[model samples]
Target: MSQAGAKRKLQLSELEELRNDAYASARIYKARTKVFHDKHIVRKSIEPGNKVWLFNSKLKLFPGKLRSRWNSPYQVQTVTPHGAITIFDPKKGKTLQVNGQRLKQYIKDSVPTEGVESVTLADPIYST
Candidate 1:
């Protein structure tokens, strides 16, 4: 084959296949390392069934369990497309409608772990 012929050898289908493979790999990676701040995670509009941390405005209503930064992770059951998300509260065993802006995605460290914050690394040493 001539040099010019070889230069244009790649078919359009090959290019599309490569793109699809890349997309699939990225989806898998996202599903695995979903460890990031809420802002980054919930950026491109959220969908129902996605897990998110419901923020607590009132300190009194907030659980005194352990993680005390300001968040409670809950599974989303409904999304309002532009307004709200209905979250399922495992503790209450019921779903509650809440505004999206008040929610945060849960993170393990650098923020606080769920209910395990108070019983921290220091507890092992100072236990009575």
Candidate 2:
């Protein structure tokens, strides 16, 4: 009976050691995955008065092969250091705050034809 009890004690200790090793393996895997995810993240910087396009992820549920998923340009109202930004929609006269990562700078092309000038990024210049 004493020998059988000793064997049970040894098996319990081995099981505990196996559990500890599994816990350590899970921790190491989590750390490595976090590092990999952080490395691929792209940082976006925006300033007030800049025009940006907002990504519209809600359109994914619908089927539109040629339709764009990004919304129209919105003017930046304010930017925060914690990657949050406030934007204003001129058409709706409404303001919205969103994550800076979801916004991308909008560049408009200016083509001048028939003595009329196009819109510029900084300011508009009229032709006489």
Candidate 3:
């Protein structure tokens, strides 16, 4: 009977040890995932007077597959401390504040064409 009690105690201790190890492994896995998620997060910055496009996430009943989800470019008026931006609409003359994550810098298509290099050929010498 004493031998049986000893064996049971040993089994209980091993079970406790396994439970502790499992908890530790879970903690380590959670920390690793947090680090990975933080690493992949993108940081965006906007300055005053910068034009940016806003993401429109409003759901429609019939969503178009090829339609662009971004809105027109808005001029930035000010940047708040907690990722909030105050933007101005030039056409409507209205201003509003929104999260910076919804905004991306606007790139215009009209690039300067004045500095293109041109090739010039010298006039051929007159034949005698």
Candidate 4:
């Protein structure tokens, strides 16, 4: 009976050791994954007077895949050291503070030319 009890204690100790090893392995895996994810992150350079688009992440009910999720042409007002950004909405005539991660640079399209050229088609006669 004493020998059987000793064997049971040994088995419990081995099980505890296996659990500790699994926890250590999980920690190492998480650390490596975090390093890999942070390395691939692209940092955006945002400054005052730059135009930016705001990501509309609040639409949870009816999220349309074809519709654009970004709201555009918000002029940058100020940038805080902690990634907080202030943008001016010209149409709303107000300024709003948002996170830098939700903002992207907005590039304006080129202006269309006013000059128009008219093309006339000539009738072609085919003889059999």
Candidate 5:
């Protein structure tokens, strides 16, 4: 019947409209989430002569969770303009170029007694 055909077309249009709305909402949500993530990201500033740790990404198959993935105390030798970093390993006396994203600044621990203070606690009296 003509009425049945009209009803089917209306239902199809409504379904198409719902799909379009869902797609638009998804795009908006993704854009907002990206902005929020970008805002919270801390930028790493690495310079020459600063000590940094290198992240090893090669161990993928059987990487032990307890083992540290970062190789520490590598001195930064040079920083290229295109974000490439050259680091020197004192133990091996070798220099290698790597991506800047894999490096994080290494902060040396200060003297153990510098910020530590002795604390004294009094015994509590028991009351019935």
Candidate 6:
């Protein structure tokens, strides 16, 4: 006897079980994240008091005014082992905390030399 045109593929439930097993067998695991606001350099170590500026993502800086942009400058107040960074804002003279993924270090070229860059954050405390 010969078995021809048999359905060989696993069912959806079987596939799901295999997928779960994959998740369980993995010794080390991390989430897959996309690099958008800032470049993510692998194997790079970040220390405290390293001095980083937050990139303002909502405001685009003009001659005398700040336009729509994203990310803002925030100093690194603290860095946890899990990569959580506590940032301090000089504009409001307050301190806030955020995750590493939520923040992007401000490059010198991104900021204007003359006058204040102009802080246009929606809230004093950064929510990330």
Q: What's the CA error at residue 34 for candidate 2, in Å?
A: 0.8
Candidate numbers sorted by TM-score from highest down = 2, 4, 3, 5, 1, 6
Count of clashes, each model: 0, 0, 0, 0, 0, 19
Local error of candidate 3 at 57, Å? 0.7
- List pairs with backbone clashes in candidate 3: none
**For model 5, how does the per-residue alpha-carbon lDDT over 1-115 read when each residue is reduced to its tens digit?**
9999999999999999999999999999999999999899767789899999999897666679888888868999999887899999999999999999899989887668777
Residue range with the least summed lDDT across 10 consecutive positions in model 5:
58-67
**lDDT, model 4:** 0.92
Cα error of candidate 5 at position 83, Å: 6.2
Model 4: residue 100 alpha-carbon error in angstroms: 2.1
| Per-residue lDDT of model 6, residues 1-128, tens digit only | 12332333346567889989898666333233333324565433545665565545334445335443444566677888877788777778888776676565555676567876677868587689
Instruction: Report the number of the highest-lDDT candidate.
Output: 2
Residue-level lDDT of model 3, residues 1-128, one tens digit each, is: 99999999999999999999999999999999999998997888689999999888783555599778788999999998889999999989999899998899998989778998887898878988
Best by TM-score: 2
lDDT of 2 by residue, 1-128 (tens): 99999999999999999999999999999999999999999987789999999999899899499999889999999999998999999999999999988899998976656788676689776899
RMSD of each: 14.7, 9.7, 7.8, 4.8, 8.2, 15.1
lDDT tens readout by residue for model 1, 1-128: 68666665666568889999999999988976775543375453557777787656776665577757555678888888666788897877888998888776654568556666454455455557
Q: TM-score each candidate.
A: 0.42, 0.74, 0.60, 0.67, 0.58, 0.40
Pitting candidate 2 against candidate 6, the one with the higher lDDT is 2
Over 4 Å off, model 4: 58-68, 110-128
Candidate 2 has a TM-score of 0.74
**Which runs in model 5 stand beyond 4 Å of their true positions?**
55-70, 77-86, 93-102, 107-128
Which lDDT value does model 5 have at 65?
A: 81
* TM-score of model 5 (CA atoms): 0.58
